[model samples]
Target: MKVLMIDDNELDLLISRKLISKQVTSLEFTEFTDASQALFYLQELQENEFDIILLDLNMPDMNGWDFLDEYQKLDAHKANVYILTSSLDTRDKLRSREYEVVKGYFDKPLKSNYIAEIINSQQVY
Candidate 1:
């Protein structure tokens, strides 16, 4: 499976990669610290290049919301997108539902169990 993670924090990205590697093999991860760059790659790349997108809600230039907004403009197919954010506010959760592509939401300090849940739920082999 091909996964793309868009988070500004390098540490979070590294930790996520580590956790993912421990659970799944033959999974290719493409990470981007910049949401805009991630968006650009998605826009230009061939269709179905990524199986899942783990996105951060709060980012620098282009936040997750903004990225979703622009992402909607493109012809990207139904790539599973999960909001991985630190915000626990109800409003954030409520607002995330507006985007049809958002498959699930996860709190930051990502747990391996949560990753396993997503993987198991999706059965993305």
Candidate 2:
């Protein structure tokens, strides 16, 4: 599986990569600590290049919402977007439903079982 992770925190990125490696041995991970850089990369990519996007909500320049807005414009089919953040706001969860690409929300310090479930459940197209 090819996964893209966008998080500003270096340590969090490190932990996530390690967790994913442990849970899903075959995963090919590409991580970005800057939302803008990630967005740019996504913008220039061909269709359906990424299986999933693990996006951080609270970023420095372009927050998760902004990234999602731009990402939605790409119009890629079956590309799952999961909110990977520490946010506990009810409104955030409610607002996430407004977007079709967003698969689900997962709290940061991500659990391996949850990651495994998502990876296993992915319907390859």
Candidate with best lDDT: 1
Lowest-scoring 10 consecutive residues by lDDT in candidate 2? 116-125
Please write out the lDDT profile of model 2 over residues 69-96, one tens digit for every residue. Answer: 8888775554788888899898998888
Q: Which candidate gets the maximum TM-score versus the true structure?
A: 1
**Error in Å for residue 16 of model 1:** 0.4
Query: All candidates' lDDT scores?
Result: 0.88, 0.85
Cα-based lDDT at residue 82, candidate 1: 88
TM-score of each: 0.93, 0.92
Candidate 1 lDDT by residue in tens digits, 52-105: 889998999899999999988887575788889998788989898998888888
Q: Could you tell me how far off, in angstroms, the CA of residue 120 lies in candidate 1 after the best superposition?
A: 1.8
The reply for model 2, stretches above 4 Å from the true place, is: none
